[model samples]
Target: MATFAMSDQLLVIIDPAARQTDGESVRIAKDVLSAGAAAKVCLPDGPAEFARALGRRGSRRPVVIGDDHALLRAVTLLHRERELAGCGLSVVPVGEAGETSLTQSLGVPGGAVAAARAVLDGTERRLDLLVDDSDGVVLTGLAIPPARRVPAPEPVASAAGRWYRTLLARTLPARPPRLPAVPAPGPTRLRVQLDGETLVDLDEPLESLTVTPGAPGTSGGGTAEVEFRPLSVGAEATPLRACGRTVTVTGPDFRYRADGAVSGPVRRRTWRLAEAAWGLVLPS
Candidate 1:
């Protein structure tokens, strides 16, 4: 393993959902961090407290111990304060596998021990972000049509197991709850614009769309990738893909999954790439 010059200052924020869903994992992560570094752990029950914990952090490097939502909250907070570029964030995923997809995608270790060790020994990596006109931030890719909630796993067998599960349900933060999947609202006409060029006009009905950080050219550069699929079944009309610094999506009212959060029902939304706007710590 590559040894890093460990920074003594570290503040670990444990999300309530993480503590509720998998207290054991959170505890293991806490133990690892505390033993390896000068770690100060904070347990925030709600969003307000979460923000306050981060705001009060002094020179300590902020480490979030939770699922994707926890990481998103931290990144959004830093982005809004315009401190993202200089901050290096670390995360230890402590929820169900489905709930921690964002962290996994970003190359964070899945196991609590590994993730915690990475916090103390990882190298910093610069990453891009997507910022909307409303000042919202997207650390991971956003999807059109949004994502359907991952169905809960089958219940455990045996009476004793069932009782233990039930106890957890009542006592925990709620297993990082997911919204029950709702049927799509039907095909909607949308006007998709890349940079200033029109990709999908208002007359064209779109089945779905996705915007991600990356440029749309032979040379990969700073830009957002915009892609959409039309409802029409044309072999020649495969999914339309393009790259640009800005992408605008306008429809009657539609929802999108940004990072892991679902948002929308607005008539218009614009997203632009903020290249290397933030840094994340990954295993060296």
Candidate 2:
């Protein structure tokens, strides 16, 4: 990997929704960054603004001061802005205990002080990103089992009010929706192709068709990626696929879960991997 210079002035973006009760993590993060260097810790108005902040991050490195979801958003932003050439990402996992190391594995830490210290002395590594032109930036794994669509949210006035409702609407939890259960016969169909070669073609019910960064094409320039795990479940007609960087899917309208967030609906999509597109802080 080529060596790139790291930045000292960091922009901290904290996810406000995640810090409802024990909100002092955000304050600790703010103080840490402001102590030794010029820092700006700001709450993103929303996810779109969060991406915009990262896009316009300039020479200042981005140190996300939130949960793993915030880390995902920052990575997604980095993936979309491949022109950065080299930019380091810092993450402070201020969420539940389970996902502490989960973020660390990706080279981020959970403690506010520890993650902030990494911003000061962490080694940078070349990491891969998932990109889908059809579905936009890809950061995390995708799960597509049959799920009941969420009902439309009620209108709100104030930003705080809207945030509250959106938070509640999303917190409904992930379970088999309370609907009239019924039985059906026949399996779902999916035709998967990688680099124009057919990988799977069938009328079988699929649990998931996971695609990862394939090895860069011998002649064509791109990520060297492949998918090994294909978890097939019971009978259903809903096609499911998980793409890492780049993927191309052909069929009817297909609903996809990208980076844990579910999209409305779309079909005939392609995904591609962006490599070394973003920088991440690792433990020394």
Candidate 3:
């Protein structure tokens, strides 16, 4: 650890995966931070190193230079370390603009330089997170029962998929949008219980299911909600929200995505939502 002079500043953690860009992100980010204010930046090797950096200095605001996924990682780490409330987090997104800029929706921005600048002046606000007391901490999103999109085969596919998706984005509208491709066929049904009360037990095969925290513009409070929509023909539907501290969902083996990343083929799972668990630094 490097000795530091006391200053109103935050610790910056650059994602290892972001390093695949050969430090361009970090360099630009550092320059941004230095330009905006006096702060120290610590570059870590990987996820473990990032978390360790946080463990050592979570009390300080954390500004991550990476994608929304990295932001998710930070949130999960805060939850795991049981230091969610005391820490404030910020993010600088890098990657597919559409995909990466989603972090901006959380108050992060795309440019490393601009993002770092925001970190210096960003406002701290409480945010909601989904915590799986058993499996792990969920930061972004999750897929629950009634839909099994097993990602096909990820070995050579994920990259190819990204390339193809990127290429498609380049030709299409400059506006961000998900590919209009139809949802994958096949569905998995799930039974959901919120705060110990059964809310849904349906046989409808779902194309996808996701839960998002209440946004800055929205005021739902510490309420956690479960939404189910049939994927065979994916479309938005009225979602089910629960005001509870715990959520339990179980069914036959199913695939789930937590915070954009996939999680399980497990049959039973539970999520505990702790409200105002962490501080998020958003654009002001």
TM-score of each: 0.81, 0.67, 0.73
As a whole number from 0 to 100, the lDDT of residue 192 in candidate 2 is: 62
**What's the alpha carbon RMSD for model 2?**
10.3
Clash pairs (backbone) in predicted model 1: 216-243
Stretches off by above 4 angstroms in model 2 are 1-7, 18-21, 48-52, 78-84, 96-102, 143-178, 182-186, 203-207, 214-246
Tens-place lDDT digits, model 3, residues 165-232 = 77866887665434344455556666777778876565755545566555542333877666655544
Ranking by lDDT: 1, 3, 2
Candidate 3 residues lying further than 4 Å off, grouped into runs, are 1-7, 96-102, 145-186, 202-208, 216-219, 229-245
Best by TM-score: 1
* Model 2: lowest-lDDT 10 consecutive positions: 213-222
Q: How accurate is candidate 2 locally (lDDT)?
A: 0.60
Task: Give the winner by lDDT.
Answer: 1
Say which prediction, candidate 2 or candidate 3, comes out ahead on TM-score: 3
Model 2, 1-284: lDDT tens digits are: 32223346878887765566348876776777777566767677789888878777777777787776778767655655655356667777787665454476465666778777766667666565566764366543444444444544443446677778678679866545354434442333556667676655655444455544422211113453444233353334444433333456665556777655677466566666666555566666
Candidate 2, position 10, lDDT:
76
Instruction: Quote model 3's TM-score.
Output: 0.73
